[model samples]
Target: MLDTFQVAKARHTLGLRQAGEAFKHVISESDFNEAYNEIRTWSGYAPTPLLQLPALAQSTNVEKIFYKHEGSRFGLGSFKALGGAYAAANVIREKISTRVGHDISISKITSPEYADLAAKITLVTATDGNHGRSVAWGARRLGSPCRIYIHAEVSSSRAQAMRDLGAEVIRVMGDYDASVAATRREAQAYGWTIVSDTSWTGYIDIPRQVMAGYGVMAREICETMKTPPSHVFLQGGVGGLAAAVAAYFRQAWRDASPHVVVVEPELAPCLFESAENGKATQTKIVTETLMAGLSCGEPSQLAWHILAEEASDFLTIPESLVGPAVRLMARPLAGDTAIEAGESGIAGLAGFVTSALQAKLREKIQITEASRILLIGSEGITDPEIYTNILDEN
Candidate 1:
């Protein structure tokens, strides 16, 4: 099931040098806790289960693999629910406070008294699928208007999901990056506050909130683990999730421990490109792949800042490997439970699987037979038709 991998020279030197002062600007437990407290207020909120895959370990030559299944995170079907929803809520709260020239706590913002006030504000974001659904769902829950812009690459099913949540879904031409750019243009003309997870110069606050919301997952992961894994292969989208989780590990783990490896599709390896360039670099992506969630062409600036030094490596795998990874996760081995990982959801596994096949990479990343691996299945079968079609393949 392995395919060609586009390996980049990793910036492996890592330590806790920035963990105190510089990282303070990135985020902290209090930031994550604030998001977690808000997320727990949701009706059916609970910690997602972390499943072990010993079969995968045997196959990849790793000691063990712990897959954090985010498929059922409040039934939104992705870890994005944490970021998108929390960003939408926080945006409205900030706007409400700004309008009244008074401090507005999140508790009061969630109360029934502010339902009318919440309905008046609008939150906007651009997503491939999961983030859009989460944003729209959050807006609906808070009685606010949410406008989601989807690029041509996004599935109609995903756009419909946002529509189902009462979001004004706008379809734009080109790729996800184009949709993001178009969303910015639309935001300027329409006057909606952008709650994007990706950040720019002036718009770091909402994205910071989004990234902080994602930190709750890391918080949960840390709480569940007595011993940390040797390697963590995280999906690299705009780098929001990777940086959020990496921020936690940077603070939690000791120097040179828990080597963080970011996994992205070779076609759209924004983080990999950025890491190589030593800054936030934009990718000139053309075609789309099944791993739509990580189909970003640019890294988030704030996320890049956190991950540039925190992450030990970056790996890019072929698109062909994604289907196999999904099947591998879906068909559990022995005592392992089946996990329905979507296209992008299985990217880290794909990267790890491909990387583990190569002896040099194993040596370079220090992935020995005793190394424990951790990966986040960031979504479930968000697109059932694609999932079915892929599973139907050999």
Candidate 2:
């Protein structure tokens, strides 16, 4: 286990470096703040309600369960839009600044100007589904050319969604990690800027930007609550979202901050494995789970650093439990109060339910009656056929 002093020291160093790097690239807090404010204004939607799930709370032996539903954001049906668009905008802004020798804000860059700029640049990334769609959307919105590479396992519906958003989609003949490799190689060859969330050596800025964009969600959560959550269960992919939430919450609440639990699918528990190993590591596990979002073979370097220091615990759930949790979420929490949640969204809830280390999890952290618990419903009803099939099977 990492000592508190070490964690604090590391976080301070990382924070300073991240802030400096972000500013140098013109992707400062002001950039994220500006994008978030604009999104709030132009998007005809409010922050999704922080809903209480009494039944879920009871089942998990917690006093309360608060679900932060992201289903309603811009009707895109997922939370990917937040980070995806922010990163895309940052990339465009930087490209413009490099050519014109001055910063160009997203709002001020007209469609024709953006199109001319975008036509000169190519936005590249790999995804299971949501992230690619989000990048495609951002590229289209900025009038940039985009090329998204996805694994063969990605569903037809998701691939079509990227195409609908005007991205040139390619189906890589392997899993998620392989697609990342393929995308990276392609980006290197063609000089396209790769805005991927998963980071490796010599490639960090775009992924860090992605995480910084995700920090807006944490800020929203803090502002929405009177007394913030006592524990936050965040699902881990390449660990971008989990790291973002954990880092921001740790900064915001100091020692009184929530116990953050990073949850992963047992089949591909890359973040959990890295946390246990006390360093960033990768594995060659085949992921055959429905929670495609959590099927990452490796953790992002920036994400690993944050989780290694600050995350309270890491938990992995078996494939068997995911379906049941998805069904349970669809059922009315109390009476006539059903919450719509996708399979990926319910993974955290499943982790809480299946964990044998429940006592250890709570003991290492803190929770009480007044302590709210926040779980992100990251996606909503995206794969209705799969969701319906899971429900019917259950």
Candidate 3:
């Protein structure tokens, strides 16, 4: 598929010295490992696989391509499952300490002894889809009540999943960024604890935990990937997942951090715009796009702190490329198993392939035949109807 969106690009760090300093100041391996250890105790905790796509590599003219398939990151069907739930758990732990007048062990938060304490707290958030489900799932796991606010454009399938998980759902009037605002207002009014993955001023810790939870996925990628990739392309929403991936890789690879490229919807390229402006910037107009998760109109402060300095490139892609990317992942050219990736799930691959195909883009992003590419397959078919429609379209 031909890409209609022009890539907005930048190289933040002058060298490994600057990149390592930026990454160290933001997050560390211990931050991610704490979450990973806690996540290991979850009922369905299992490492998501890092699958090699040689045919994809050959097609893109790269030496190798490794896709960390996160479709089955727990049964929630997206990497968001790792984040919101873990943050909810952490929030509950803090509440538990407040209730008991002392620090409590992390494992005992969900214990039968503290079940009533956990139930006393209510967690809330706004989402396009995956994050809300993960928050609801987290609340469900800790026996806490959850409520989610979503914008008008959110698909019914995603809303229904949240409802199915026993979360109260509210529909707002605008787009995802609007729903986040709505969630903030409603949270303040009701005194509900907002366990969001995105961060703002005076609201960094919970999101820090949330991103740290996502770090588990990054840690797994590093531990499993034998040959470190030359480039790590990640899809950006509020930048939580992308930053987590970038941070871990930056730490693990040390002075040899991969060329990190952040991808987002052209209609909602807040990160791309932020990188270009050299500061966090909000989108003037929020618009519809096929990649719901990437349809945010603002950048997260927490994410910006990590991404602005560490990320080497940023790309905003058109909706037209999404359908073909999904189709490409669904049918592998070689004997590799077909990946059941959704529209948002394939954004990294979409951006990577788009850049690799064009000589200018390849040169601009510093891609060549010797480069080893890594694209995260972020979600599975979370929305069956949209998945089927797009899959059938292309």
lDDT of each: 0.82, 0.72, 0.84
* Model 3: ten consecutive residues of lowest lDDT: 8-17
Task: Report clashes for each candidate as comma-separated counts.
Answer: 0, 0, 0
User: What is the TM-score (0 to 1) of candidate 1?
Assistant: 0.93
In candidate 3, stretches whose alpha carbon ends up further than 4 angstroms from where it belongs are: 1-20
True lDDT of residue 363, candidate 1? 76
TM-score of each: 0.93, 0.87, 0.94
What TM value does model 2 have?
0.87
In TM-score terms, candidate 3 sits at: 0.94
Error of 1 at 394 (Å): 1.1
| Local accuracy of candidate 3 as per-residue lDDT tens digits, 60-117 | 7899988888889889889999999899988988999999999996777768999888
Candidate 1: segments with Cα more than 4 A from true spot = 1-22, 110-112
- List the candidates ranked by lDDT, beginning with the highest: 3, 1, 2
Candidate 2, residue 372: lDDT: 60
| Winner on lDDT (1 vs 3) | 3
The ten-residue window of minimal lDDT in model 1 covers 8-17
The candidate scoring highest on lDDT is 3
Please, what are the lDDT tens digits per residue for candidate 2 over residues 243-292? 77777776667667777778887878887777666677797767556888
Q: What C-alpha lDDT, on a 0 to 100 scale, does residue 297 get in candidate 3?
A: 82
The whole-model C-alpha lDDT of candidate 2 against the native structure comes to 0.72
